[model samples]
Target: MLEIKNLHASVLDIDDSEILKGIDLKVGKGEVHAIMGPNGSGKSTLANVLMGRFDYVVTEGDVLIDGNSILKLRPDQRAHLGMFLAFQYPAEIPGVRPWQFLKAALDSKADANGEDKMSVRNFSKLFDEKIEAVGINPNLVKRSLNEGFSGGEKKRNEMLQLEVLQPSLAILDETDSGLDVDALRIVAEGVNSMRSPERSFVVVTHYQRLLNYITPDVVHILVKGKIVKTGGPELALEVEKDGYKQYMAEAEVNA
Candidate 1:
């Protein structure tokens, strides 16, 4: 479970322009929430701030996971508390093989949970199973993480991390972008397989196409760094059909 209250965050320089203004959201276990917004609505900023990115300054309010404040925690500490953010654009880390990265992640998580470290052979078996489930080539495990990978491959790699890490709350920041229909299906399947009463997801996307694959329990429309409306899955269809014109008008009236 996660709760954000009156969150006012801003860039850390010059005028210190705020991007997330008085946000209030609650995500319970077994829930999927989709945030749909136009460009410059601060969706990505919310994701980064939740991950404890240093460039953003929190001017007010707090972020709590499982009833404890995490505003002061380091990025790794927040990660240890079962938070994962799949970026809109995954970075390519040269010289870091997928196997090595996964091993480190597994070990770190194991240490966090006070479990025994996994052996290389055992981890390889688990990795093989997950990679197969996500339909990723086993050969990719030997290559640098995301290096020279196709767009779909990169998205699959992020799903691979989702499967391996198994965090309690996964925030996917536009994972469907740049993905073809086949790739989107694969990614959606991967996410769906992980849905459980003990887990939740926050999917931030621009289009309703992704929602067709991963239906959210709630859909929120964000405007001008604030959530202007919240509704069920039907709202996604309405947005796709009529666009954000109505939502923008409502936002202007509220402003």
Candidate 2:
């Protein structure tokens, strides 16, 4: 459902320090892919580039969703095209309540698809159901979005968005970070519940703890902006046991 071909991206403000040299990846429907790497491996950069973040410029290649090139599309345009990103660190909107924020996003998506807006009653019903499913208190929805929320709560809120929006492709950028074991399990369960033949997920993580809950179909090792290894779930175990030392050594040799 998503394809990246020889993608190269770099920050435009500096001397154009290249982050992603050439990232080529393909994720099909119903597939779960995990990108594991050390710091400065361009894992987060790839996510931002896919979302068309302004700080980074794509110097070469293309990112295609389905069959269309999405490089020219704005961030909102990418979202409208069934792409969703759960950021590693969710932003805090102090004044916006959870319901209001979600309703606005959902309405914008509906309007983009030429569909009628969701009725207040229907939205309330679905919202409550989603909140309960994610183990969030209904009263929390009335509070400001992610303002003073615990790390786990923010992660759950992200999953709540995933549950409501149900985007075709979801890129979860370290959603498991800072989560306690119980909270991590809850978030992982929420993500696992969304698996389907029509949906796909790309999970970027540093540890294999999250992978224990969500088994990925393909595991890719990214070192120095390139995917150095691709394998099954066993690859995650190897990383967890031996760390990325071998991978880093290989990368140094290649460089």
The C-alpha TM-scores of every prediction are: 0.97, 0.98
Residue 93 error, candidate 2, Å:
0.6
How well is each residue in 139-217 modelled by candidate 1, as lDDT tens digits? Answer: 8768889998999999999999999888999999999999999999999999899999999999999899999999999
Question: Candidate 1 has which clashing residue pairs, if any?
Answer: none
Off by over 4 Å in 1: none
Model 2, residue 136: what's the lDDT?
Answer: 85
Cα deviation in Å at residue 35, candidate 1? 0.7
- Per-candidate clashes come to 0, 0
Tell how far residue 95 is off in model 1, in angstroms. Answer: 0.6
Relative to the true structure, candidate 1 reaches a TM of 0.97
Task: State the C-alpha lDDT per candidate.
Answer: 0.91, 0.93
lDDT (Cα, tens digit) per residue for candidate 2, span 52-140: 88999999999999989999999988999999999999999888999988889899989988999999899989999999999986677
TM-score for predicted model 2 compared with the true structure: 0.98
